[model samples]
Target: MKLLFIGSRLYDDIDWYVKRKNIESILTESNENAINLDLPDQVFIVPRGMDGPKQVAVMQNVDAIVPLIGIDPPLIDVAHMKEEIEQEHGIPVIAANVRAVELTSNKIKTKKFYDEIGVVTPEYQILDSPDDLTLEFPVVLKQGEGQGGKDIKIAKSMDDVEEYFKNFNQALCEQFIEGSEISIEVLGFNGEFVALPPIYKGETTLEGTHPLSKVKTGPCMVQGLDNNLVQHTAYKVAKNLDSDGIFEMDFMYSPEKDQLYAIEVNTRPNGTRYLTTATCGVNSLCELVNMAIGEFSPANISDKLEYHYSTEIPVGDYNGPCPNEPVKSFDDNDFVVHGPEGYQRLTARADSKKDLDNLISKLL
Candidate 1:
């Protein structure tokens, strides 16, 4: 069947579509970015933010549309574009509806949905006014549509809270839940769903800029976690929101209080799409396409995939170098990157963390 992969600028998205055999794949890009070789059936680079019918008409001949756009500040509208595209064109949407995407993209809205369904989230308050800072100090405030802790701030005192809010427009304030934070990636088709093994998020620092910002994801963090609990919780969120196809849900675990707080819901493929697939052995793109084609059944939904874990490290210490193009390194030795099925290792080389950090950080 013919499929149009939206948000195709991302490497993972491109890789996903290209890997599927015997399918017509059209990759759309926002800007004139370079595409990795070995592409799928067909690739097209559409102008950025071309969501209106005039733009999407390019794919009127395609059977279904699969969006691969990442989360953005205008995320609610971005996600809702799925429905807009479907309605504008007489094609079937392979994921959540516009209303559902709106609910999940807006943090406050998502929390309310979770509350209505009896799902446990954090003790958070949406600050519509300056006086809404009635909560005590040490509260964490994150940007509603922000990612990787870009505009996050911690208020140690009421004064600090007030001062910070004056600078930022939209934010969600929550009582500090001190403990390890864990994130899980799940893939779903129709009403049937499968929760992949959870991954541990490590060293989330807001030191230089934002503390609540995400730095890196490690192996499964808390052991003996009720996998069933995580699965049930995630499924409930997906089902409650009537989410379809692939999605990612994050959660925070307060070990001291023994509480599980539901975090934000990623309505689109996350930055770590490859990492999740590496850990879970689930071809989200393939499965998503299959589900879109009505190939999923309840009996085959729970087939668990295996994922190994590993980390990124520098190569060596050859300090002094002066050249036009900067140098880099990757560690094949460090045990940080591992999986049972596939051979995972550092794909490049560098000297120090700072030097290695210069590599293209984004997944695109």
Candidate 2:
């Protein structure tokens, strides 16, 4: 089987899996300097949008297309391309459709979607100005579109709201819920979706600290929250979207209120994949390759599930050894180190919590 994968930034993460599947890889990148350009069987330096990729997919006559875009801006374009390619031709393109991207790409739209779908989300009001704010202080001020905590502020006062408005005229103000921040990856393809184990991303702070800077653990042991509830809710949301590929959903469980609030949905590969792969033996990136090859299903995911205690921590600069293989799977090693210099993170796993602690100590 041949696959045309758009974007080379994340190719390295799944190159081993693609090669192992005996799938011929053709990649398109915006620049020649992108990483893992040489890993693909063939690479084409196309322009930055999905237009070039769609054209290349046809010209190459690839069997399928799997977009590896990690950012939000180009998802709409990719959705359009996916729609056209799959409709004009019979080739499968593993990605979210236009409606899914439209609903998820914007924070305000996502909140409305959650409400319409009967999924609980934080109370929100669109603020054209600071004077229009009614969500109360300690609310989360955010733009309609951003990721990784970008343009997000915990407003403690009117001054903070005014301070935030200097750059943007509008905001998606939401009531800040102080509780356990959780993330889950639900893989969907051909109308079947499977929500993996929940990951605990730590408690929220008044400073609006993102999970990126916090230590996170998998198979969430939060006392009042049940993993089944999380997985069921995530599955519902994915089915509502009715899209293919991966959906990385962010949620918060407030023990005080005994509520689980949906925060965001990213219909692509995300930061949560590393810990998800460690906790459960399923790798989302590798699964995308499987989706293109017609191998993704609920039964297949069930067959791959392996329970383990896993945790990811920010080391800033990891002076530790690397994995036995280039892949991120923990089959050969207890730990996998990722990220760039001065911002590296280590994800370690073990059979038990005690073993996990000991493995972490040894890795550190």
Candidate 3:
């Protein structure tokens, strides 16, 4: 089967799988100098919208399309293109649908969606001005849209709120929950959804720490919160989304209050995939290819699941043992190092916790 993949930034992450499947790979990039342009069989340097990729997909007569966009801005256009192309041309687009993107792309709308689905999320109030604030201090001030903790602040006083308002007229203010932060990845195709193991992303701080800066481990071992509960809750959210491809959800579990609160969801490839794949042998990105090839199902995923203790640590640079060709993949190695030069992270796994500790100590 031939496939058209959008974006070259994340193409390297799954390039090994695409080549292994022997599917003709076509990639598109807006910038001519993007990194992974050479990995695909054919490369098209298209403009900055879905129109270019849509045109390329149709012209190439590809069987399916898989978007490797790892950011939030282009999802709506991809969703729009998915609707039009899938309906008219009968070619599947392996990504979230329009309704799912609309519900998840906005923070306020996501909170309301959680409420409608009976999932617990933090109490929030949309603020037009600092004077309208009702929640106590130390609240999370966020815009309606952002990722990687962008444009987010933890306010301790009215001054903080006022300072935040200078940039935007409105804010989606949420009561900050102090507890362990968890990230779970769920894959959905043909109405079958499976939540992979949850990753422990450290604790929330009064300073509003972003998960990207913290040390993380897979198959979370929180004291009071159960991993099954995290998985079940994630599965519920993905089912409600009623979309395809990957859904990465962030959640916070407060030991003080003994409560679990859903934070937000990213309906695309995310940063948590490496650790998730290390812990359980299921790769969400590879599963997107599976969906395109008509090989995605609960049975296929269940058979691929493997238990391993894994941890991801941020480092300055990597100078240790490396995996084969696609060094970032977990296919034949217990560890994979990724990210840009200065901010690289090494993710490794083992059969037991002690073994995992030994592996990380030796590697780092």
Model number with the top lDDT: 3
* Candidate 2, 119-184: lDDT as tens digits: 999999999999998777689999999888899999999999999999999999999999999999
Error of 2 at 261 (Å): 0.5
lDDT at position 300, candidate 3 = 92
Q: Encode model 3's per-residue lDDT on 195-259: one tens digit a residue.
A: 99999999989987667678899889999998899999999999999999999999999999999
Q: Give lDDT tens digits, candidate 1, residues 113-209.
A: 8889998887888886557776666788876666666667777777777787788765688887666666666666556666766655653333433
Each candidate structure's count of clashing pairs: 16, 0, 0
Which lDDT values do the candidates have, in the order given? 0.58, 0.91, 0.93
Question: Which parts of model 3 are misplaced by more than 4 Å?
Answer: none
* Model 1, residue 239: C-alpha shift (Å): 0.8
What TM-score does candidate 1 reach?
0.75
* Clashing residue pairs found in predicted model 3: none
Instruction: Provide the TM-score for each candidate, comma-separated.
Output: 0.75, 0.98, 0.98
